[model samples]
Target chain A: MSIKITNGNATDEVAPQFSAERMVEVQRIINQYPEGKHKSALMRILHMAEEDFGGWLSVPTMNYVAGILNIQPIEVYEVATFYTMFNIEKPGKVVLEVCRTGPCMLVGSDNIIDHLKLQLGVEVGGTSADGMFTLKTAECLGACGYGPMLQCGKHYHEHLTTEKVDALLDAFRKEHSTSSNN
Target chain B: MGRKLLLEHVNVPGIETYEVYRKNGGYRSVEKALKTMSPQNVVEEVQASGLRGRGGAGFPTGMKWSFLAKPEGVPRYLLCNADESEPGTFKDRYLMEKIPHLLVEGMITSSYALGCNQAYIYIRGEYMWVLEIVEKAIAEAYANGWLGKNILGSGYDLDLSIAPGGGAYICGEETALIESLEGKRGNPRIKPPFPAVKGLWGCPTVVNNVETIAAVVPIVNDGGAEYAKIGIGKSTGTKLISACGNLVKPGVYELDLGVSVEEFIYSDEWCGGIANGKKLKACVPGGSSVPILPANLVCKTAEGTDRLMTYESLAEGGFASGSMLGSGGFIVFDEDQCIVRNTWNFARFYAHESCGQCSPCREGTGWMEKVLHRLEYGHGNLRDIDLLAEINKKIEGNTICPLGDAAAWPVAAAIRHFREEFEWHVTNPDEAQKRNFGIASAHVPLV
Candidate 1:
C-alpha cells in the first residue's frame, strides 16, 4: 500500500492546514471538551478536515489536525489509520461504498458489487481511469432490513436492484460530468 | 397488535418534531423521573422492569446502570451507544431515523436518573444522515426547554451531544467507546477499571444502547412492574427485531418478548414468512455474533419445546443446540442461500474488525476466514473442517473482550449444525464448486 500524502510530501515543511471557515468550526468542536483535554475533538476535527481537504486525510492534513489539538502528529496518524472511513489517498470524485457484510451479502450485495465494478470499470478499492468513481465495499451500515444498499455521501440507496444500480451510476456520471465541466 | 411501546407514535405525523412528540406524551418519562421519582427510585423501577442490554450481551440494563460509581464531586456521564454496526441489526437506526425525539426524551430521563449533568450519543460515523436527524432533535429539545440548564425548572442541568465514531466496530465496546470519545484509536481497555468505575476522562460513566435507552421511556411511563408484565419472565418489555435476508418483509418489528419464534418467522405481522416461496434453511436470530441455528432448532428447542423469542428461551440448549437473541438482528436464510459462504462473509467481517489488540482474535479470525474461504471455493479436505473448529476453540475465551467469542460462536455453530454440508464440500469438490447444496422442503406457517 502506497502511503501517498497530499502534494506527495510527508515532511514538516508541507504545513498542512484547514481553510479559515473550517478553523472556526474546529474551535467550536474543541470547546465541546473540557479545558486541558481538547484532544477529544480530534476525531471530529479530522472528519471535517477530511471533508475540507478532499475526501482523504493526507499526512500533512493529519499533522495540521494534531497541531490544532496541541498533540503529537503521531496521535493523528494513529487515529486516521485506525479508522476505515478516513482515506489517506485521493479517491475518485464520486466514491461508491457498497455494503458487503453478511446481511447485505445474504441479499445479493455480491451481485450488486459485481454490477458496480462492471459499470464503473474499476475493481473493488480501485479508482476509475477517468477519476470519476471509486468502488469500495463497506461492512454493514445498519441498513440490514433494507439490504443490498450502498452509501454515497450522506444518502443511502437501499433495497437495491440491478436496475437501481444502473440508474444510480447514470445519475452519478451525469453529476460528475456536469460538475467537472464547471 | 402487540404492544408498541417505543414505536407507538412512530407513524404519527410530526412525531419527529418536539411539539408533536410532546403533544403525543413523548417526554412523559422525563417529567415523571425528574419531578416525582428520586434518583434511586428511578434506578429501582428500571431494575424491576428486567430490561436487559439490547446490544447483544443480554446484560440486565438496570443492573448495569446501578453499577455506576458515584463518588463525591465527580461528575457522571451517560453515553448512549448508537453505533449500530452489527451486520443484522438496524432497529436502533430505525428508531432514531423515524422518531428522533423518543431517544432524546429517553436520554433526558436517563441522564436525570443517573445524576449525569452531561451526556453524549456515540453513533457510528456511517450513519451520517441519522446523526443529522438526532442533532435536529437535540436542537428541538433545547428550544422546548427539555435540555440545557434548569430543564423544566427541575434544577437539573443536563446537556447532550452527538459524537461520531470513526468507523471502527470495536468502538461499540464500552471501554473502546470511552477511548474513542477521548479522540484516540478505539482499542478496548482492560477490566477492573471498568467504565462504571473509571470511564470517559476518568469519570464514572454508563453507556446504554439506543434501544435500551428508548425502552426507558415506556418503563417510566407504565411503571417498572407494569412494564415487566408485557414480556416473559426476565426478558420483560418489547424488543425491536430487525429481520432481514430472504424475508417477505424485511423491516424492524417491535414485538413482545414471549412471542414464539415460529410465529415471528412466518406471521404476516412479523417477517411475513420466507420470500419467493422458498424453504427456511437457517437463521442468525440475533446479530452476526451469535450462533446460527438450523431451521428445526430455530422453531423448537432440543427437548422439543416450542421456542419463544425471549433471551432465556433462545439460549435453550446452550451453545450445542441453541442460539442467542443477540442484538435482535434476526437474519433468515432461504433454501438456496449457502451457509459456508454466509459464515465466510461473517468471518471476513470479524477479521476486518478485530482491532488487532489480541493475538487470538486478530490471528484466529483471519485463519477462520481463510479456511472458510478455501472450503467455500472447494479447495479444502475433510480435516479442514476440524481445523476450523479447533481455531474457534482457541479464540473463544482468549481475548480481553467478548469479540473473540463473538467471532468463534458462529463458526462453531455452523459446523455443529451443518457438518454434512462441510464434508460434502470436501468430498465432492468439483460438484460443490458447481452448485450450492440447499435444504429442501418448505416450512408451513406455524402461526
Candidate 2:
C-alpha cells in the first residue's frame, strides 16, 4: 500500500559505479536492440547496474545507466522503481526474499517467513544489525510446486525448513566475509 | 499414462545440450517444417491440431498466428512469454529449466511459420537461472546453424535472444510484455491496434507462452491432426500442469486433456491426493487468477456430470460453480487450509503486482487486500464480505488488461463459494484470531 519512490535521494554520497567489465556487458545488452531502440535494454542494463553498484539502485547509479542508454534520468528511475526486484535503497549483502503467495502460504511459507524473522533477528523488510541480510516477503517467483522458497541472489532455495534457512544464512555469511576480505 | 509430448526427453541425461536433445529427436519439427512444409502449411498444421495457447487464456494458437498483419517493409516477431509469475503457476519455469532447447526448437519452428526474422524469449527477471539456461540454449542453437542466418541452407534466417523482465507480474500479459520489451514500466496497452497489427517497436508481432511455442515442435512433427487426436473436443493435445499446494506430490505433470479432475487429485500419477491424508476442501484448478471451486463442484459440474481437465469441462458451470484452466497452475487445499486466509494471500499478491494503471484495479486491489487482511486477522463485520464483492465487481472488466479481472476473480470466487468462511471470521472474531476457519465440514458438521 505504501508508495516507494527512489527519488534521486538514497544518500548525499554516491560511493561507486559500474566497472569496465560490467560496462562491456551493458554495452552488449544495449547492442542487443537496434540503434535508437537501445531503451529496450533498460531492464537488463539496470540489472547490471544493480549488481555492479550495490544490492540496490541508487539515484546516481540509475543516472549512470540512463547515460549509457542515452535515455532520460527520470526514465531510468521510473523503471527501477516499477519492478519489485530493483531495490531503490541499499539492501543488505544478502537479501532473503521468501514467497508468501497462495500456494506457498498453503505449504507453510508463513512459517518460513516467521523463522527467517526470528533467525535473522530482523522483522519483515528489516535488515540485520550487521547488514548481512534483509528479510522480505515476495510474491510467487514461479516456484509453486517448490513452495516455502526464498531467492537469495541468483539461487532459489526451495522446500525450505528452519534448518535449511540456518544453513543458507551460514553459507551466505561465509560468502559475504570471503568477498569482503577479497 | 498420458502422452508426454513436450517433456518426453526431459529426463534424458545431457538433454540440456543440443547434441543430446537432437539425438533424442529434438528439432525434428524444425527440419520437417523447413524442408518439407511451407510456412503457410506449418500454420495450417497448427490450425488443424486445434492447439490452444497454453498461457492461461486458452486462445486458439493457430488462429492467433493467422491474425498477424504482415505489411511490406515491416518486421514481424514471435516473442516467447517466459514471465511465468502467476501465483500458483510454475509449469513454464520447469519446462524451460529442464529442457531449454525444447523452447528454442519451438521458437525456431514458430519463427519460420510466422516469418519472424528475429524473436525473443521475454523471461521474468526472478527466473535469472532460467534466463541463463535459455540464453545458453539459444547460443547453442546459433552455433549449430539453427538460429543464425540461412538455417540448414533453407535460407530462412532467424535471430533469437532472451529479454530479461524486471520482476513485474503484469508483464505476463501480452500487451504489457510488449511494453516491457520496449523497456517501459510494463503498463498494459489498450487493444484495437493489437500486437498482431502493431507490436515491439511498432512492428507486427505474435506473443506466445513458453509452452505454446514449445508445443509447436510436437504439432509440426506429428502433424496437427495427430496432435488434435490426443485431447478431447476443442481442447486438444497434452497439457503440462504445475500441480502444487497440500498434495502428496507437488510437481509438474503432463497429462491428456480429458483426465478427470478426481483422478488428477487422487491418483498416484498426479497430485496424489491432499497432504497428511486430509480431505479436499477447495482448489483453484487453473492459476491463482481463476475462480476457486469447492470440492463438490470440482469433482462434478453443476449438471452432475463428471468434471474433466479439459478447458470446457473445467469451466462447465461458468463462474458460478466452475473455474478456468488458466496456465494450469493447479493449487489444491487440504481440509486444514482456510479459504479466507488463502483468499487474503491472493489479494495481497494482486495488490502488490498491480501496475497502478487503471484506478479500479490500482485502487480496488489495494482496498481488497486491506479489507481481507483485517478480516483474516479477525476484525470485520459481514458487510465487509459484500464490500469485497462490490469492489471485485467494479474492478473486473474495467481495466486495460485482464489483471483487473485476475485480481477480481479469486476474491469473487472465494466469497461466492465460501461466504460462510468470511462471515465466520466476522461472527467468531475471537475464535478466528485464535485459529483459522479450517475446512467448513470440520467446524460445522453436516447432519
Query: Largest lDDT belongs to which candidate?
Result: 2
Instruction: Give a tens-digit lDDT track for model 1, residues B369-446.
Output: 999988887899989999998998899999998889999999999988877777767776776565333421111121
Assess the local accuracy of residue A168 in candidate 1 as a C-alpha lDDT between 0 and 100: 90
* CAPRI class assigned to model 2: medium
Which runs of model 2 end up more than 4 angstroms from their true locations? Answer: A1-17, B435-441, B445-447
How high is the TM-score of chain A in each model? 0.88, 0.89
| DockQ scores for all predicted structures | 0.76, 0.78
**Global lDDT of each model?**
0.87, 0.88
Candidate 1 CAPRI grade: medium
lDDT for each residue of candidate 2 in A45-111, tens digit (9 for 90 to 100): 7777777777788878877676666668899899988999999999988899999898988888888
Extract clashing residue pairs from model 1.
none
